[model samples]
Target chain A: GAGVSQSPRYKVAKRGQDVALRCDPISGHVSLFWYQQALGQGPEFLTYFQNEAQLDKSGLPSDRFFAERPEGSVSTLKIQRTQQEDSAVYLCASRSGAGTDTQYFGPGTRLTVL
Target chain B: TQLLEQSPQFLSIQEGENLTVYCNSSSVFSSLQWYRQEPGEGPVLLVTVVTGGEVKKLKRLTFQFGDARKDSSLHITAAQPGDTGLYLCAGHNAGNNRKLIWGLGTSLAVNP
Candidate 1:
């Protein structure tokens, strides 16, 4: 079975440019999560979605960070006017059932702002 | 606020050695999960412990949840070079089950 995957495994964006990271979760998974991980640090939650509805966006650092899962399958994390602080690895994970269930993670998109 | 603190941020040991990583917090959690991540890859779940004072073993890896549900530990016996990577511990709070509170993580290097 195909696991969760992310597109553009590596992205180098100039400062003030915009970037969109894509994630394709496992088929039929209802819950999806986005996390940001800095170098040598653990992942920090960014947002969460259950099916098509975005349940939590509290972890999003600023208004420039936006995420959408319009069709309830593929999720995108968009950063507008990217800054040096936005450079980090963006990870996506999907779960089979409720919150306590195991979450399968994708390879993640490493975004570097130059 | 919930915070998980992991001790010994970095460890380097020879193959066949044993090591234990610890995660501690002041807040109680509904469950705790341990994950291993290699360079250029997202984390892979190793084990999840739900019950207090529960212990679960995965091959050479052992996971234990504290009796108060506020801490956890991972013990790896006879570590191999393949086990080198970042070990992360995440906790699910009862109030916010969907979001995981993660620790700083421990980076282990096993030399053969």
Candidate 2:
């Protein structure tokens, strides 16, 4: 069985640049989530999707943060005009069902906004 | 607002010692989960507690959900060096089951 995976394990972007982090969830998983983890901090929720529909984006810190899961499979978290404050590890997770289902996480993409 | 707070941001102990990590919240939660993460890796789920005052054990690790579902605790006994990592607690509110409120995490270093 394959676990969740993310591409571009490490990304270095200059301030004002745009970066897109990608995540591939387990096959047939119905739910996906994105979280951001700053230095010495726990992961904070960013957004959530159930299939192709984005259910929650309340956790997104600002308008610059955007995410989408098109066709109900892979997902992308895009940060526009990256700032130094955007430096963090972006984690993606997937679950087979709703509610309290255990989430399987990807290795995560470490983004460094310099 | 729902928030989770974890105490003792860091812990260092020798092998075979016992330690406990706490997670507290002011709001009730429908479910609380514990996760362990190592460097350069994502968190891996350890356990999920849904029932109030419920207790579950895995190996020498024990997990407990508070009687009011507003807190949780994780205890590890006979710790090993391999247990060194960050422990995080996340709670899904009783009202909104999808969103999870996360704790800052407790970094534990178990020396051999």
Candidate 3:
């Protein structure tokens, strides 16, 4: 693809419902990142992947938040029993390599837990 | 935890005016990057400064890195309505880890 692509541009789920968001990064990019952006706030890092390896999950807020990059090209972020606090924009970004490399971002999925 | 503090959470100015936004941190960074984001869209890269005391200009926009590598500033000369957007600064630590520490963005509105 020309740029990173994310699925379900918008999702509205009732509290306690589970939802999954997907991201397709630029072809052959080696680094992937997930972030959570709250209303009127900057995006906060959620997780990072290098190819198929999930090297950093320190930013995941709680056990309810999970992310995986099984094949190294696409990634999924799943939220279990979503809460009102979980309502935010989920952003995915990819970089060609490591160390100060520029990142390309997807449009992001806006999740609204009602 | 590495923290980057950005000033002027919001700014509104008339077209042709000038403005500057600042990002500060106590920790030094190996490199710093600036991004601009519009509503319903992802942030796009503006510039990256690696060396301390480096300055880069992109047409009407100018970016400067602090001599200590702990701060940066984005200045727009004769700002136009097209420059209205959210500006963010991200810093990479001095290590192999490529994770970025981001600053709370500055939202600028240049009204015509």
Candidate 4:
């Protein structure tokens, strides 16, 4: 599809198990964003990447959460030693450019930790 | 820290009913955007209000941006069953060129 796409529509991991979510953005998109959405809450910013550079990751909940957009296209969000609180939908979005660009979002990966 | 709060966290109404959802924040934003998300799918952009006191309409949905740029609202006229979904409001943080602060969405269920 022309819109952003994320892998593993649903994932269930045991506590302490690691999981990696993938996102494929629209072709030629310059900005990519990762968000965590807890049930009954909004999607909170986790990290942002402008091309291959990760400009902001201050929103990541913990050091175990890591993301990267290598080669400036597809991106990956890796969570180490997952916890029950990590259960949430992970959403990926991409924008065309810097300012005022409309964000196109993916179907999102729902991670369930047990 | 910037935070957006949405009212009526959950709403249930019959088709053809009218409803309004509100989003408020103390922080000023350069732009405010509305999105609709279905279960298991990501949000789709509905509208973006940049100018203060600006009002934009999309079909039965009308969006308004507050004069202070710290709040916005979405009003639906004669809502339909198809309109059942989570409505989200997001405001752009000028400090972060590409980041948007999101409000906890209002989940609306329209029964036919």
Better of 1 and 2 by DockQ: 1
For candidate 2 chain B, the 10 contiguous residues with the lowest summed lDDT are B91-100
> In candidate 3, how many Å is residue A73 off?
0.7
lDDT of each: 0.95, 0.93, 0.93, 0.93
Q: Write the per-residue lDDT of candidate 3 for residues B36-104, one digit (tens) a residue.
A: 988888888999999999999999999999999999999999999999999999988898455788898
The positional error of residue A98 in candidate 3, measured at the CA in angstroms, is 2.5
Q: Candidate 4: deviation at residue B62, Å?
A: 0.7
**iRMS of each prediction:** 0.8, 0.9, 1.2, 1.0
In candidate 3 chain B, what residue range of length 10 has the lowest lDDT sum? B91-100
Higher-ranked by TM-score: 3 or 4: 3
Worst 10 residues of 1 chain B by lDDT: B91-100
Q: What is candidate 4's CA lDDT for residue B51?
A: 95
List runs of model 4 lying over 4 Å from the truth: none
* Model 2 lDDT per residue over B9-51, tens place: 9999999999999999998889999999999999999999999
Residues B34-100, model 4: lDDT tens digits: 9999999999999999999999999999999999999999999998999999999999866656788
Worst 10 residues of 2 chain A by lDDT: A95-104
State the local distance difference test value for candidate 1: 0.95
Residue A34 in candidate 4, Cα distance off native in Å? 0.4
Candidate 1 ranges with C-alpha deviation above 4 Å: none
What lDDT does candidate 4 reach at residue A72? 98
Native contacts retained per candidate?
Answer: 0.82, 0.82, 0.57, 0.86
Instruction: Pick the lDDT winner.
Output: 1
How well docked is model 1, in DockQ terms?
A: 0.86
How many clashing pairs does model 3 include?
0
